[model samples]
Target: MVLPHRLSPMVSAFTALWKQRASLKTLILGDFTQNYLASYLGFAWAVLGPLVMIGVMTAVFQFGFRAGTTGSAGIPFPLWLACGMVPWQYMAEGFVTGAGAITAYRFLVRKAVFRMGYLPAIRLLAGSIIHGILLIFLVVLLFCYGASPSWHWLQVVYYFCCMFLLLLGAAWCSAAVSVFIPDIVSVISIGVNLGFWLTPIFWNLSMLPENWQIVMQLNPAHYIVQGYRDSLVEHRWLWDRPLLAHVVFFIWLFAALFIGAQIFKKLRPHFADVL
Candidate 1:
């Protein structure tokens, strides 16, 4: 079936990427290694960096702020916090790095044969390697806290896919636009930092009034964060959440992908010139 003219560019980009899936894998793995090539610990930093951040955040909130007393589903506060923080680290890193994906590889942007479309996915997937390790750490932490594995744990993959697609859309837009407006990278960085607090990583949504909770749920990151807690700590399925939350989350997800794709496609032709 023929796609509308507006969607053809977006669809074509995906088609090209699939055709070169092997190269995409090589690029992602290569980029992931180069990310830590100069460090003494090498790839271990992928696991260590986030673990340190989680440890520090857990200390400050659980101990310093006395937030440990509030546990979700009787899960320990640290475990609950890890569940949220693990996915959040992926989202935050994906946004910051993905925004710069195109700029960071400007040499490739000028290559006529290169598919610039793969840049954002390269950064995102590279970061996913780190994300997968952090997730393992989270599972061990949960087990240490006496939380047993359950079928609901499988939902983490579903949530990860949700977050990945959401980021891909946003990344395509930001990476494309950042070519012309360099400040967009900084803007996204600031937004992600603010999003960390605004999102309920350290706190629970139940702390808010019912009406306000609805408002907070509108944040796409809120859905992913809450989904992590539900899957790991609360042992609930995705459908178990309010129907409205699912609707709102997907609304944001598709809107991001659709709008981002159009914006990326529209600006793509000019990227070579800007770079």
Candidate 2:
């Protein structure tokens, strides 16, 4: 027989894991089904959506957003934009979806013990799969358009891991707050909008003046977007030395996960009641 104390966390974790397995699987299947349900081309829309956006950004920026800088990047402007868009989309969608994890399934939270944790995990997984598919499509498109990967492509794996950890930490915090104040979801919506503008999406950071560049460094997404462009387009390794800023980000992520879990546990009792 197993000891109660020894098996407690494992048992709790496992029960929650099993509860979510079906929901998570269903989420993936449902997303794929619904995403393509109305389209004449079905799943082709996934590829087409990003490609179309890539085309629009390229055209508008190449014409309207022109700066004096050139050749700072190794890839074409469209390919460079695609590289940034693919990962940034993942991060944004993951956080937005994760933020409402608790509110989405109010019934389960009211009835279950460990199930709350799985909601965010499932949302993250769903976003991850979508992002992964988009990345693969981008790679194939780039290759077809004559963009070849060097040893730097090897760094994609590392960048992906970084993005995952960052998402996990951020998602936990967002989900935690969502349980207490449903308005957190709205706040996140506005925040993501601001984040998109703050981030170097259509334009390169080099285009910014020196003082503004220093300010942009404070945004975690900035480094991450730059990291993706570096690894995929620039073919560089993950940052070699951890800077002071990165250290601060790592600390924030850790703190968010730790504090968020406790907050989730604390508020979990009332989730069902509120819902």
Best by TM-score: 1
Q: Which residue pairs collide, candidate 2?
A: 110-272
- Score candidate 1 by TM-score against the native: 0.94
- lDDT of each residue in 1-275, candidate 2, tens digit only: 56455334334643666766876688656655654555778667655776788788888877677622332534577777888888788778777888887777666775644466777776777667677788888789678778777787777777677776677666767887787788888888888888888898767777789999878877778777777777776765666634765776667655655566556666666777677
Q: What is the C-alpha RMSD of each candidate to the true structure, in Å?
A: 1.6, 4.5
Q: How far is candidate 2 from the true structure (C-alpha RMSD, Å)?
A: 4.5
Candidate 2: where are CA atoms >4 Å away?
1-47, 65-74
lDDT of 2: 0.71
lDDT of 1 at 64: 90
Candidate 1 structure quality by residue, lDDT tens digits, 179-272? 9999999999999999998998888778999999888889999999989888888888898898999999999988888888899878889988
The candidate scoring highest on lDDT is: 1
Note the Cα lDDT for every prediction shown.
0.87, 0.71
| Candidate 2: Cα lDDT at 261 | 57
